[model samples]
Target: MDYRLEQDLLGDKNIEVSSYSGINTARALENFDLGGKTVNLHLIKEIALIKKAAAMTNKKLKFLQEDKADAIIKASEEVIDGKFDNEFKVSAFQGGAGTSTNMNVNEVIANRAIELLGGAKGEYDLVHPLNHVNMSQSTNDVYPSALRIAAIRLIRKLSTSLSSLQEALQIKENDFADIIKLGRTQLMDALPMTAGQGFGAYAKAIERDRWRIYKVEERLRQINLGGTAIGTGLNATNRYVFMMTDIIQDLTGLGIARSDYPMDITQNCDIFVETSGLLKSCSVNLLKISNDLRLLNSGPRGGFGEIILPKMQAGSTIMPGKVNPVIPEMVAQVSLRVISNDTAITMASSMGQLELNAFVPLIAECLLESLELLDRSVVLFKEKCIDDLLMDKDRCLENLENSLVSATALVPYIGYDKASLVSKKALSSGKTIREILLEEQILPIETIDKILSPNELIRTHISGK
Candidate 1:
């Protein structure tokens, strides 16, 4: 393999002739090879966007020659289009507070721009990574700003997925509106409710999750993009500082703005912590709802046996003729992983020192993973599980009839003391509450029939005539 020699401050290194990345990226590959997880492509693309915006801003301010700025902009656009995805070779977990990753992007863009300008790949004389492509920016500002951009994009996708999931739940709620079942509290039968009502509760929970994700995305729009080094705009001009966010907002079509206090944005990572907490809240809802679906779909014969989940695959290797709620199980597992990622993000955000958070790479990895996981899992859950759910109306009615839960409906008519006695009699004799009420002539047969009716029992407001 023919190689080209490139040099950074550390020393000279040999880069492959065909590689777009230069010495800094080559060093990062060797130094931070701890994790096989590479930098997120989303973050890479957003960094490319920032590079393009910075180049345009420089050209506009007459700080860069038009020809050089055009080359950098073109290279950045190609990177944004993911044409050079393989060029970003640094590991996601690295020291230097994401400097390695940022420099990795800078090197790749600079080298590619060099190529576009009719120069060889390692020709820094034509397009130096730091002097040309990364002008007026520091890793401290660029890395976090790019992270926010990537996160905002992913948050929009996640919010859309949550909306779809909520819609699927709402559809199930409407479809199962007439199927009456026993509602349990603390694993014991408490009262009667339509299966639709149960699903409606799940729908409302997801609705809240969607709203939270949507609202919290606003926090990511304020960025410290021009706060070079330590948020003082030290090496960057005030004109460039004021113009960069607008250029980025125009390029990415997002509502991004410059931070009111760039130093605050640079010094504190609480916004990420808060955003991660919202993701955790969404994960909590997903975990609970997935478990609820699993419980409701537990058995063909041995469990709740009320609603049947879509059987995605064979349940066991040894047991024959068994199917499992694999979709909800998968959703549950994804939820668990997201919840765990939230913890990593929280710790990373809190571990930030005085000037900057050195843990932005970990936070980026975990937060992006959570966002992608939830987006994909929620879509899968809706299409594979919730949309195809089958309710056993007879099974629900049977469970409702066999349990003492329906006796609560009788309380409105027969009074609490009499309803308690009825429930006790039904439990002792192993007869249904309806059968006991009928046999004991606890009320006129016509009234007993009215009170025990599934539709009547599931009514929000039960009254005795």
Candidate 2:
């Protein structure tokens, strides 16, 4: 355990000689130890990108010497490549609006740059964290901009996963196109529908989610990267301020733009809230679809049992030969967790003060976690559950015939009053609607068969009379 002394405004502390983090990061490690949950690696990598862009911009502006800029650029690239990931030890729940995380990145980049420049790790004189690596940047601008970058990258991934999930549903929809089943509303029988129609509806909902997530990436593209401190580019030159976004865009290969009102972008965080709300909407659809699948796959013996999910694992400790709808259940839980993360993100976004939001780290944590969780869960759901789904055609027909739901189709010919009478009679006598209708001679056998035919009953479009 050899160490080197690193000094900050507070005092001096011994940093490990081999560590690539400086005094600020060391202080942050000691100050904010909330549950040992480190900042997201995506955020760290994006911030490193920002630092790299800033160094290049500074060198172009002649603010940093070429040698120092090159060292910092190389170090920042290493950080972006995750070579120094273990050095970012700050908590994700830290205060100062992610200043701790920002400084942690700065220190790691600076120390790594120092080592690259043939200087000792703690040699700030050669490559100072703030003066060299964080030139023309502040946590206020850098942190939020980096967060947007990380979030947009992750949002793209989520959109892709949603697309895959939608495709899986569409495949199932086609496979089950002719398998007629009972449609339930309010936990009661409603009408007859093909299992394909049900899966088609799920696919449509997920398609909307995919588009929503894809469109929201546009909102995140406008950033306030040069609005250092309080959206007033005080220490940063006008040239640097104007050039930052273009440099960052080129470096990260994202279609990012500078904010029209950097102050507004710096002060407000509602974009994140809006993004989280969209995620919650997607989660709502996922929860609904998962519940529907669970119901469709409910029981081979006792439940609706209209369809069977892939047998993932044993359902119970004591029940032999029992399998559970584990993938849908996992999808349901992930959706609920994403919903909860949305709530936290909403709260954290709304709690920002006049000029800066100190709660962005929490927002980043929850939002990134939600995105990753949904992406993985959706892929698992599609591969493990939706793709291998099996329909119990007999069970579907049995449930459809056992219920009085088909009485609604009788209304077109027999009128509503007659339909209700038929339903009531079928319920009371424990007979099916078709049986009761035929017994009472409500309609001719030819007409009755025409009305209750699966093709005639499940017609999605109406024919003009």
Candidate 3:
């Protein structure tokens, strides 16, 4: 049996055989052979789930008897316990409809179970890969199920990171409550607002995104495990689908359910698109917050100079004194990457044109990468950028005092035109608006205080800290 010359059931007829040696040859042969691995970790997890489900339903499979089933179950337990992670090393991006990955997992589990049974390796003669270990299953059902389960687990971990970041922002909001600053419209000063108000708004946006993720998670729970090979269920029992869902729920402790329309669930990748869109929406909010932080901390001497960011490091070796907002800048870059990955996922989901979506591997890659990046970026942004941020109270107050935005607050006092006159005088002379109003007698001192006091003005339209 020349393993190197093996061909797959699908396309790739022109693939030349590689007769090399060592691990590299093994890898090439794995690719050349009927595709996907023996035991995709995801497939292993799904198989364990199915086993649990079958046990509960008492639906006996022909290949799975008492001893072999126990051995396979024990091997799967080793997998769930994270013992065989190294053996299932074949890339998810394999040939042959993931048969290589499936077979790889199957072989590893069989070998491990053989060892547990005090037997030698490659003893598939006793616990065969296709015969007993993979009874009532195919790569189609197992592959996608594993993919969904892996994605669900990753999304759960990333959601925890997001929750941590949102809580950090809420704490910052309380810390900066009394710090009044000039709010900008189109980069121009428009009104006075407490710094806390801005942080609070960002917090609220993140909270909304968190709820959106919770909703998306529900979509992930509806999987198509029993819809083997284009929803035909050729090799599986009618009782397998619902039982598998229940098994997965018990295994993962997550509320995963079977789809009502197994055919649609098996054929469609739209759920991935929907979930990716939700993640992108959350990334957009993160970008918004990061962009605002960069702008707010732009300059301490020349630019708006309203807020000061934690000086991460010296800006340049050539410059004697310079500090850059590297943390916020890094978060901005990661957010951009996440946004771009979301677009890739969208294209992958949309490109599925046939009865079964072939671009799932691509979607899985993009979604996993996006979620991991977002998870790290959120923690980094919260700790390095938002948490350590400093508010330059005097500078903030000074900028607010000099800004001409106080004219809006005076509309109730001196009328619109008169307030505009005061604004023009203050801007032209570079005097404080309060001073101009008082010196020109356009409004009384008490009226100017009522309208121009930063605290009073911020408290009027904006919520008080």
Candidate 4:
């Protein structure tokens, strides 16, 4: 472990780590000490974008040779098939503008390609990392392209998770449609509504989120690979950019396009800001829904008493037989974390001072972490919260029957003044409105039924008509 001796033997020389060293997926992984974080193979979504950009330029590089291209293509296929998952050890916080990540992938692909060609270890002479594997590409272009692909992949998973949550809400809407309860405003009972109506609103808000994320996906597909090294296309051929784009398109099946303005591409990380903002918007929606569910399921015996959530575990160690609304509570907690990550993304995007966004590494880190956490939250909500929701039908009817909300319907028949008088009396005397009206004898039973049946009131409640 002597520093000078080790440096002489294995350091500055870049002393050929066996082509097999990099290829020995295990050895590369262990020696790199990359922590447990790998370049998520799911990030192929970003890799695919890079490949397409490179193919578009028709660059005719070593990596594009029939055999080498075929090899990289096959390795990429393995990534899609989820083969090289753990090898993506490049940390999101790495220095050199993701040069370490770019080289990690280049080296891994080169070694794997060499092995595929029946070559031995240290065989970069046959297939060099820079000379063959990364031909016609710089870390600047490839790294950003891959980051975009990774972000796109994360967004897609998030969209699916949100969609599942939306569908669960929709199903609950129909299931709870007939269970009428006292609706609240500012946490105070204000009117009558069906449990179905509340759940339906949640579903609709999530549906809106799915569409907002789709717009971000659209923006992610625009990459700046051909504009290497400050977007000047320096050291790159015009044909290289177009051909690389075409090849990657065939490989990944993602409809990626070259940046119309390459110079702007390097100078700005606006897409990351915009996409992250959209995700934050979705997080806001999720927080709102989580807060609502927590309130709705607040108490089985003490709180709102409107609906029952499926109990997942004991609410407390000291309290016996306690079933808390743990699912919604967990989601609310996760939402706070997601919001915090959004703040990090905002700061990272803003700190981009010059032609290149030095903070991109941090931006990618926060965004990917948020997406993964959101995915877990959405899945937990769909499975533990929404799917198992049940309405306390009798309780709902009981609360609705006693609420003064029914007074609103009386306005048209009895006038607001009389209705207010009746409401105040009923509130004070602890008498049902039905009993008060009957005692007052101002309206007949048939008139009362026509004006204020729960079903009719709920119809009015939903339609506002």
Give me the candidate number with maximum TM-score.
Answer: 2
Better of 2 and 4 by lDDT: 2
Clashes of 4: 33
Q: Model 4, 161-211: lDDT tens per residue?
A: 889989999999999887788888998768788888998998999999888
Model 2 lDDT tens row, 130-208: 8888888899999999999999999999999999999989998999999988888899889888999999999999999
Over 4 Å off in model 1, which ranges? 412-418
| Estimated TM-score for each candidate | 0.96, 0.97, 0.85, 0.84
For model 1, state the Cα shift of residue 197 in Å: 1.0
Better of 2 and 4 by TM-score: 2
How good is model 1 by TM-score?
0.96
Over the stretch 1-465, how does candidate 3's per-residue lDDT look in tens digits? Answer: 223232234433222222111232245355656454333344446544554444333334343566666777777677666676666555655545555566666665665666677776555566666666666667666666777777777788778888888898899899999999989999888998898899999999988887787667877877777777777777777776666677678878888887777678766888788878888888888888888887877776777666678787889889878788788788778878878878887887787666676666667766777777787888888888778887888888888877888788877766888878888888899887778777878766666565566677766462111
Q: Tens digits of per-residue lDDT for model 1 on 1-465? A: 999987766778888999988787888888887767999999999999999999999999999989899999999999999999988878999988999888888888888888888999888989988998899999999998999999999999999999999999999999988777898999899888888999899999999999999999889999998898899888898899888988998998999999978988887888888888998899899899989888988878989888888878888999998998888889889889988988898899899999988998899999988889999999999999998988998888788777888788788777999999998998999988888888888788788777777677666677344
> Which segments of candidate 2 are over 4 A away from where they belong?
460-465
How would you order the candidates by TM-score, starting with the best?
2, 1, 3, 4
lDDT at position 144, candidate 3: 68
Model 2 pairs in collision: none
Comparing candidate 1 with candidate 3, which one achieves the higher TM-score?
A: 1
